[model samples]
Target: MNASEANFDGIVGPTHNYGGLSEGNLASTRNEGQASSPRQAALEGFAKMKSLADRGLIQGVMPPQERPFLPQLRAMGFTGSDSEVLQSAAREAPRFLKLVSSSSHMWAANAAMVSPSADTADGRVHFTPANLLTTPHRGIEGPQTQRALSRIFADESRFAVHDTLPMQPMFADEGAANHVRLCEAHGDAGVELLVWGREGLGAYEGRFPARQTLESCEAIVRRHGLSARRTVLAQQARQAIEAGAFHNDVVCVGTRQALFYHEQAFEQTARVQDAVRDAADGLFDPVFVEVPASAVSLNDAITSYLFNSQLLEIPGEDRLVLLAPEETRENAATRAYCEALIASNGPIGAVEFADVRQSMRNGGGPACLRLRVVLTDAEHAAVLPSCLMSDELYARLCQWAETHYRDRLDPADLADPQLMTEAHTALDALTGILGLGGDFYAFQRV
Candidate 1:
């Protein structure tokens, strides 16, 4: 198999899924006498647009609504219109989807390569719109991701692509134990690679310790062996703000952190020069150069702090778009971010910033919205200390785990720790899945 087929590792990320969903409700609930800030006003405006869209006033311009979700919106006292305003809004709106339930948000994968799964008997992948988002979510189970997975692993020669869905229910900090259970299962399966990181925390229902997450990852790595670089522990650059190293922000190749602080962008260039001396690991890429052309502002610094970090690889050309934004407004930031991408001179694909905007509405940017799942070459590479003994052992484990755990731990069971545990116990059936001799974490639904 070619590199693409052997390792179909790609960045398929979503924007942070915060604030946008309830902006309309938030705007309507407030007293008319209350004052609002520009950020609040912008949110209110966005809320209004979404509100108008919901009432059919903005129709195609807004995200596609689900039949069941509509009643919930109406019950919430959101009475609007179904007039012709929708056509106008739709016309003026961007062609891409926004932060909505159905049609509004989008999912994108890195464009570097598309691969096929080697484990499959046949080497073909196909997808339809219906199954696209079906992989997983907090409440909804859309088929979009399923379709993507299907297409990615259509044939045996393809690298099996899987969707890493966030364990739902929303929590600022802890996540349901079930989500952790799912992580265990996917890792042991040795087929489906899961993505995760600090960004994934926002999507989970409850909060858990970062150590808990790291430990969980350690569990997977110990059992199945990590396939790709999967960790959320890096520090990214920001102009003046103290870096958010707690969230795994790290300096990456294309971007740079300011060595010295200055109001003027030109003065900042000198710091970039000073910092370049320690350029050991591809750290001096253009994105990291704190050039004088644009000094990172407070908000811009925050934007950069959350995004353009070591965890993600934004092309230099596309990187400029995010770096050039002056206004921190959600809409403006989204516009500039997308524009930079559209204007890129690289081989990147289309990125509808609406999805990102919607994600931000929830709380995180693009980087905060994804998880990392490393794909390794050995099934049991983490064990055995070498790759040779893993192949036979891994195959044996797969068969045992499949028959024993398949019935108990369905994907939906990832929500229940009880069930997840049951699933994990059965995982020994597939010892061949990995060569690792360490203890395994199974998927027992709670």
Candidate 2:
């Protein structure tokens, strides 16, 4: 199989703001009501994508969803014109309006769970959008996300873009944010590690809500037709979830063969490791970079997002590189651990820090900004060329952000009709630049 791994990052939308809509995310709740810079956010995200592309990694872009979601409000029983919909929602249901207007889709990691061609039954890469039933705001993204994924993966011969997993709470899927894939190379048949936050059908819940469910993980495995031998399921530790590790990507990130994670990432770390080794018995030996709690306390790990960084084998170097947020390098404890990690004779040889403060303020880190998809040669070619990162495309996108995005956005601005008009106009222009058809978005279809 001529396969390659592509990281598709969501473009920060024009209406990007600090809504504090995610209940389990510390940063989101802590930064509520703060003004946001959409231009800066998009620029910073673009820089991350460009850096990966510069290192020879294949990078793609997912367009942002429409914001100030009047369509959703109308569906929720708001009447009259779009302006009335916004005003009535603002006047009668302000909190709900704020939640629905959130631009949380920028965290593309939650977009879907993907199984590569090497791990699929029909040799087609499979995509199942996470139902996101735990969050009412995010739950609305399912249909649109499917539309976008279907458009991007239009070639059914090479891809299988399935609908979002069932919308019920029992099958609440959080997509790749809670999943990990490890293999010798992007083309190899890798081990798929499904991390469920809690038992889907279990009774009672934790202090902080668990977003992914065990039943959802099993459903993904069966639907993807992943080999039972190469698949392993693990539950996220209750402590991690309580500590604001809402998604597995917040506590661990696996790339190639290295499972870079914190000591408290899973409920039974040793058992998970053993299962990984057993699954990869014939494929290859797995590299485990387990960061002990004493080295980086659970608090420090969550605070600095040390484990949430992207751990990948540098395209040509073969040595692993950790692309983390500036916070990881700025936090004294996490920075120290990062230095020690690279200094040690381990698989990780380099650490790169980026200024993604805008996204971080909204509870997104480097790894949170991407959805990794391993695609074969033909499958890769089918991706929209304009969405791929290059010097030219990066420059264009930077210009697009500067030209269309706002300098500062506040929660109150969600009610502004002018803002909605501007967002629609900007997204309309974006379709042309991304080579997405005019009808790629819900609004565009209207």
Candidate 3:
């Protein structure tokens, strides 16, 4: 089962905006109520995917979920025609309306927990949509995400699409944001690392909620039918969480044989790495790059998202490349450490910066904007063609974004009937472009 991991980035939606909805995510809070460029956001996201595709890496795209969630408002007791619902909700519960319109799904890493065939019991790749019970806005993404994933990975023989976990606090899950997979090679058996934070209350009060629970991770492992021997569970440090590293990916990321992390990433960083090393024995030599808190503090790591950079094996080199945000290059401390890390000639050979500041301004970095799925050639080919990245597809997507997405959106804009219409019109065209059926989105069904 020799394979390659494809990076499936979520195309930023036409309603992309900063509502500062995420309580624990510092960037989101800092940029709260700010005007955003939906068009620029989508273009930047596509560029990142195209960059990877041009580099000859397997690259894919995840469609964004529909926004201006009217159904949610209806459930909350606002009822009437589509425009009426938006108007009433806007007039009565303006804040709630803004929360529903958030395009947080642009950060695709939270879309699902992926288990490659190499790690699953059935030898079939698995996709489980996240419940995202940690936040009010994100919690609504599950049902639609489930439908979208099942449509893309529909083949029964090669893919298994699991239902989202119940939206409960004890079983809260943040998808791939709290999960990582490391292997000697894409095709080899690997270790699935699940990171949990704050098992109980009075647990190092971080002024933010630790989204993923130990119970939630365990539930996913069982549902995915992963081998316990090949699994490593670690607790996220409260220090990192308080510093605004809400998800584990914000402080660490792993791919193939390399694990890039910050010193304060986990509660017992040494033991966590030791466990990973032991689990990977006979598989591949694990490469560990730890940025000591002395060189780059947790606050800097979260602020710049240096650790959130993608650690992809370069096209023709033995070393990895760090696909980071421009913020990392501009930040004094992170930039210095990044330069020194590459100069050290370690597993990381070079650092490439992408301008994804739109998403980054709302708490998502490069790694946060994509979901990693390891697929065999057959499995890869089985996915919908439009979901995969190609030159023709890239050009088409760019055109689509420009025509459908707005140039600017503010909190007040969430209530605009035209914004809702624009999102629906865009998603409608998108379904056809991606070969997703007419009924893929809620608006289409209407």
> Residue 65 of model 1: what lDDT?
16
Clashing pairs in 3: none
Angstrom error at residue 6, model 1: 16
Worst ten-residue run, lDDT, model 1? 173-182
Off by over 4 Å in 2: none
Segments in model 3 whose C-alpha atoms lie over 4 Å from true places? 200-204
Worst lDDT run of 10 residues, candidate 3, spans: 198-207
Per-residue C-alpha lDDT of model 3 across residues 1-446, encoded as one tens digit per residue: 77998899988988888898899898999999889999999999999999899989989888898888888999999988999999999999898898789899878899999999989999999888999988899999989888988888889899998888877777888999988898888898999999999663234445888888888888889988899988999999988888788999999988888888998899988899899888887788888888898999888889999978888876797688898999999999999998898899788888889999899999999999999899898998898878899999999999999999889988788889998998999999999899999999887787
TM-score of every model versus the real structure:
0.30, 0.98, 0.98
Q: lDDT of all the models against the reference?
A: 0.25, 0.89, 0.89
What does candidate 1's lDDT look like per residue over 283-315, in tens digits?
A: 222222222214333344344332322121233
Using lDDT as the yardstick, the better of models 1 and 2 is 2
Q: Assess candidate 3 and give its TM-score to the true structure.
A: 0.98
